[model samples]
Target: MTLEADLRGASAATVRGAIERGDPLPGTAGFAGLVDGALVRDVLGRELVYVDREAAGEGASAGARAEANGSASVWSFDPGGLADPELLPAGSVRPLRGDPAGEDRGEPGGRQVWTLPDPAPETDEGAAVAAVRAAVRESVDEVGSTGLAVAFSGGVDSTAV
Candidate 1:
């Protein structure tokens, strides 16, 4: 149930064995853009990530890579960021880019580098709800009494927090 504001910190910390994501939330979920120009959507697809329809695609020049690189110009978790955005596939990882420092190709859905692992396997409906509730509650418990005000956007993720 981490807020989008927290993603900056969480994403910054998720490199290999040194993740510092806030808890009682366990492991990870949601959308995160790595410093290495990779875009990741969580296995649950709980958070939506989108790429500009015109900006989506694979095989481009280095210049196009710089322009994409999972930066604000090419990707947004909120669909409103683009006039027409393509919902990034769930549990997927891809680079929003082109070739190195050269010709720019206008394409969509760039080459996928990795598909995030699904750590939470399929479970019974009730069990799934319980698990989700537990994770969210753990996160809420940590954040609720912090005495800092949080802005709620009324989205399912923010509302849960």
Candidate 2:
């Protein structure tokens, strides 16, 4: 199983647990940190979606059933993650549940916003630094030997890696 996200809270751990439990999706906030997110099937034949609850038009869909963000006006249930406006024509409108104020009713849409716990304060700064150095060194060595390629865009994350 593979996950892609700039996760916060217990999201990474939660994903690990979900993989161990053989669950597709572990939690919703596990998806909150994503930007320009979309659902698609990977080469391994696994279906994945990235949904940010606060976003207007993002949700996870497996075939006919889709959970869309309440604010979204136009949505696509594309399995290939390519929702290009010019290439792909408009998809059918699948309305989500809402109140008079247009707030998300949740569920049925499979929208569950998880409140993550506050991160524990860091101690043993030197040890933490050393651990990070060791991990990064290991990663660099492995990537060097394997000839690695990253999805780089000169961002902080890409550069740091």
Candidate 3:
């Protein structure tokens, strides 16, 4: 079977099993399959990790690594009644929900905390297109380089952007 067919045939359970058994899958680029309308990967190639609904809260190791490296930051739109920002130290966990009224806001302590409005829905195709164009322009401006590199995965979202 083709790679796409193999990916389509693989289930989350099967991928998780492979991870547990420390077995390597053939594809270098990860696969994205729709699970309840959310694009999810059975394996994350760089980290060789598997994530699904059941494994959502399984980022403790990544979090720990970030903390160890002092590169941890939390980006959220709403502080969620967090009056004392000091309560959240660097590498602390924060939940994301709701929308911000206006521009993004940030607070820094042990970890960097950024609160920005939730992204507009994908239904707003024009807005999405404009945002991506603006981002590309800004990125190119900052880089001040002739060529632009896009870490593309031949996925719909990256391709569209």
lDDT of each: 0.48, 0.34, 0.32
Candidate 2: Cα lDDT at 113: 28
Estimate, for each residue in 62-97, the C-alpha lDDT of model 1 and write its tens digit: 122213333434556566655557776654555546
Please provide, for model 3 over 31-135, each residue's C-alpha lDDT reduced to its tens digit, 9 standing for 90 to 100: 332222122233332222121211223322211111233333222112231221122231121221121211122221111222223555778889889988999
List where candidate 2 sits over 4 angstroms from the true fold: 1-74, 77-106, 113-121, 145-161
Most lDDT-accurate candidate: 1
Off by over 4 Å in 3: 1-45, 49-120, 145-161
Q: Output the worst ten-in-a-row residue range by lDDT, candidate 1.
A: 15-24
Over 4 Å off, model 1: 1-9, 13-26, 57-72, 98-161
| Cα lDDT of model 2 by residue, 1-161, tens digit | 12343322325455445434545445433222211121222112232333233223453321212234332322233323333221111111112233222233333333322223456765989988998899988977776535556677887887676
lDDT pick, better of 1 and 3: 1
Of 1 and 3, which scores higher on TM-score? 1
- CA shift at 136, candidate 3, in angstroms? 0.7
